[model samples]
Target: MSEQRADVIGLGMIGGGVAVSLARRGRVPVVYDIRPDAADHLAGVPAPLASPAEVARASDVVLVAVVDADQARTVLSGEQGLLSGARPGLVVVLLSTVAVPVVRELAETCAKAGVELLDCGVTPGDKAAENGLVAILGGAESTVERATPVLADFAKRVVHCGPLGAGMATKIARNVITYGTWRAVHEASTLAEAAGVDPAKLLTVIDAADPEGATLLSWQRMRLAGKPETRAMVPQVERLLDKDLAAAQDLAGRVGVAVPLVDVARKHGKETLEIRVREDA
Candidate 1:
């Protein structure tokens, strides 16, 4: 791993981490962010600074990890975007958890430009990615093969999810479950407290249900444990659930499915959305 092979573009946390990993793997990643200080933060680091367009032009392997599908479009189609800088047979990996429509739209755009657009979202959190143990899903055999070394530089396991956009789809679905489950726990615990059932005891009991419950539940327990230092979420439980519920609802509507429990939790979550995001953000 040296600096010669380091050439990628990133714009998100995952993107930042990937760029750093690629640098460690001998790749000099071209990094940028809309934030004014994005470049200065990484200045002089192995990861070099460049505008989104410049990176896209210089990068043979472009990784888009924007916050949402909208940002993805802006990065690839905006003035001086990826398409302008991309060469033939370029590998454009969409590593964001975005809507299926976003993936398809971006796919069409990349196809028109003759670049191979692969929806390759990854999960496994920051620690896993840092250790190269993240899971990658999407792309075809040849496409996956071509991208394997780059992926391996940041992931321990990579699975091609059949066709294009599969990675994006898988990530969206996974988030819907995870965020929905998080909201469910918050709402349930809130209800329990309102009913005079000490939610503390309930969380303790739930944490023991290993086969059925999950580490997610354990996280909820930690947040709602009544210990002021760790009970940060208690004040804004309603809001956290609200944002995730909205995300889940958005996902459900996209899939043309109805999630009743999710709807109920969201209805309860909205009560806290404004106060929480404002403070947290």
Candidate 2:
């Protein structure tokens, strides 16, 4: 890889911040965006290009940071697409959060065009300029290596998960955990508030109980390996949860507030946990 910065094929929040980060390090990027005035915000940092093809023509590595799979496809295959002017062996790093299948499909498209493709998912969204993102990379080792020099310009941490689509898979799973945890917190807060426990104090108590976050760490560490232990614990856990949930349900009835999630969890907790029990275990 040359010392030149990779071109940026979109100038949205993440891409624009990445361009600024690269430029702050004295690596000016060739930039393009669908909106004609997108480059105006990053005046001194990016050299605006007419199209994705123009950006591809000027730089050996181009980062595509479009919004979705449809826009990603259009940027690569539509008129004025990057492929139109990309040289053979040009590295195309995808920074979109599309489906895993989309990454695989685009990898095939890049292969057919003699281009190297890397599925690179970044997190901490628009903070790339201040606190760089964690880059989740998926591709052949050679392809990942080819994009590393450029990725290092904007990413504080780069993890090569596996070959082709693994980055997006990791990202998707990451989202599930994030949003799912939020949902759980919301339910807990509602239940606590209804039961006359202050929600803020509830959070404080939770923090004190697991100051080092050992519970989540243990859960992650034993995710697949704790089948036998989990099976054994399920019965006891069910009894405890059912007792609490029964009290919670009674409180909710008195308070005239509905607790749909707690109700459902009470009814299905054992059945849900039972799925984790391995047949052999």
Candidate 3:
């Protein structure tokens, strides 16, 4: 690697991890966090900086992994933000999970200042600094190429999602799956425990049954192929889902347990799918 450094502006879970990973690879990243203790963990590994502007001044690619959209803006445009010292050719990668519009607006701001900004959403959280997370990138191809070296140091998989906000959009969609699955599993465990089955055992069975993950992937692939094709699979799939949901609802009612999401799924699942497929198509 060149003497030019990669910097991190946030030392939270994701940022801290990435800093450690970069230092482990001998990158010797310059990192800064609002919380003094957050950077304490990186001690000798990263060259700790006092502010985002200093980090931007010291590095070639600056990774912004702050909290939310507001924090992201603060770290990038606030008094001591990265933009204060950012220059042309500085690639600022946003790893925080914010809305698509925020990413686009930031990209424009970066452009106005002659800085290159890429929305690079990361998954697997803190473990990413060690086990390597997946990087979902959105920006011009040349910019993505320029950011590859830094990304490769901490990411196991790098996907160029599309222009500007696409990476954030994709990440938000993934968040939906993450939280929605959590809710579904919670309800499943509740129902299973109520019906005399061990929730852990149910999870084991589920894992065993879908070891390849094709169950969900198949639906995703179908939708990706377009609505006409997805529409064809819906009739049969919806029938099975409707029947199963009806039975599950009956079981829940008999056991005096409420599965409201299940009921909602039963009532609007197909419609939701139809709307999404059509809209995205």
Q: Report the number of clashing residue pairs per model.
A: 8, 0, 0
Error of 3 at 56 (Å): 1.2
Clashing pairs in 2: none
Each model's lDDT: 0.66, 0.83, 0.85
What TM-score would every model get versus the actual structure? 0.68, 0.82, 0.87
Clashing pairs for model 3 are: none
lDDT of 1 by residue, 43-109 (tens): 2334344456677666667777777777788888887787877777888887777777777888889
Top-scoring candidate (TM-score)? 3
For model 1, give the 10-residue run with minimal summed lDDT. Answer: 272-281
Residue 272 displacement in candidate 2 (angstroms): 7.9
Off by over 4 Å in 3: 2-4, 225-234, 269-281
Alpha-carbon deviation at 156 in model 3, angstroms:
0.8
Q: Using alpha carbons, what is the TM-score of model 3? A: 0.87
Model 1 off-target regions past 4 Å?
1-6, 39-48, 211-281
lDDT of 3 by residue, 1-281 (tens): 65557888888888888888888888878888877677666734554678889988887999898889899888888898888988888999999998888888888888887899999889989676683799999999999998898898889899999998888888989999889889988998999999999899998998999987677667666666677666877778888989999999999998888898899999996874561356656
